[model samples]
Target: MRTKQAVAAFAVLLALAATSCDDGDGQAASGNSQASAAGNGGQGALGSDGDGTDGDGTVAGGGEAQLASVAGADELIRLISNVTTCESPSTDPEDTTFTGVDDTSSETAVGQESATNAEWGIEERATCDGEDGSANGHQLIVVSDMARFEAAFKARQEEEIAAGEGDTRTRWFVGKNFAARIYATDSEERDMLSLGTLGLNCAPGYTAPPNSTTQDALVDGCVLTDFVDA
Candidate 1:
């Protein structure tokens, strides 16, 4: 789970623009409360391997970074596809199919960007930084693989079923409360498990109360920006 901090304003966005397209939207995203800093996407972090400016212009992050811009949405997706190429196929709880990176804009918001990952066949919502789904002016941090996503979603669904719950629609969403931890360290193989989980469980659109473990974990285990920043 990437740390959650309201940007106050587009202050950081302006900053990252100057430093390529870093946008600094990822500044407070370290330590325990956040996702793997935005660029944290490694070979699979980038959308595919698009040919446009990864905001970084270089389309090349030296370390194990998710290569922000990579090429364009298509190329970025292709790159992600290359790395996450699994041999077997799995069915999801919703009977939905996850193809991969269909909606490139879901990486971040643009107020009116089109093609959300939900539109695509992803098992879970991605960690797109584009709030409203814009391709630029914001950096998108998406997950590369989907295996873990299938498990998590299915687990959540099973949880609902075991509880004799009705209507899965009201139970899941694509965001999380502050403490939804994926793992102690980066696990790309699980990819964006926490991020996707957060997306599916926290948003208001999903009517279920948040998982108590998730909320308790967040409140009991960490400090929020409001406490530090305020």
Candidate 2:
């Protein structure tokens, strides 16, 4: 899944557990990148496991809401897989200049980690499969800690340069707004469907309070903080 173009684009940039699907209008999954309002929207790559309709009428939440308590990984995947894209699609969701670091699958598949990327602490990566036993989309991954996440981002850019992915003209912008740390490959184009699963959103993007800024973009209640790695 690691391609030179996509990897180089995100050389220093980055989070979210696992995001996929979006309203890509022949473009982005749905051309809706505006992000969901709090729990109302979705992010990340939600596998086509569930559709939020449990044979009944109820909304299932992910990591940060009421739905999470009731839903499992499958439900989470479905939720992110069904969101709309941004009003206007970004220039290229595959901009790897900011997020270039790479790591093989760590194990979490795509469920919530231990708070930090290593949220499991030392849980020893487990093998998670959907209830149906079809491991097509359920794959949790281990996320890097805040410090490592930022560092790896920088390192990837250097690696890319060594490989001649882009030019020194590339730049990184750490916006003080809210945004998700999206994980994608070279050919991947993220829209709302997939973005929803990753959970890299928060009331748009805002600068974080001194304490809120961590490896992942955690918008503490509304205050935003953006960090560009390229």
Q: List TM-score per model, in order.
A: 0.18, 0.24
Residue-wise C-alpha lDDT for candidate 1, range 1-230, written one tens digit per residue? 22344453466777766886343434644332345543343233332335322333222233221112232333333333332332211122221112222222343343212233333223222222222232221112233333333333444445555677533331222222111111111233234332233223312122322211121112221211100000
Residue-pair clashes per prediction, in order, are 50, 83
Per-residue lDDT tens digits for candidate 2, residues 128-162, read: 22233332222222232333433434445446566
lDDT of 2 at 229: 26
Question: Any idea what lDDT model 2 has?
Answer: 0.29
Deviating ranges (above 4 Å) for candidate 1: 1-76, 86-159, 162-186, 193-199, 202-230
Q: Candidate 2: where are CA atoms >4 Å away?
A: 1-76, 83-144, 166-190, 193-230
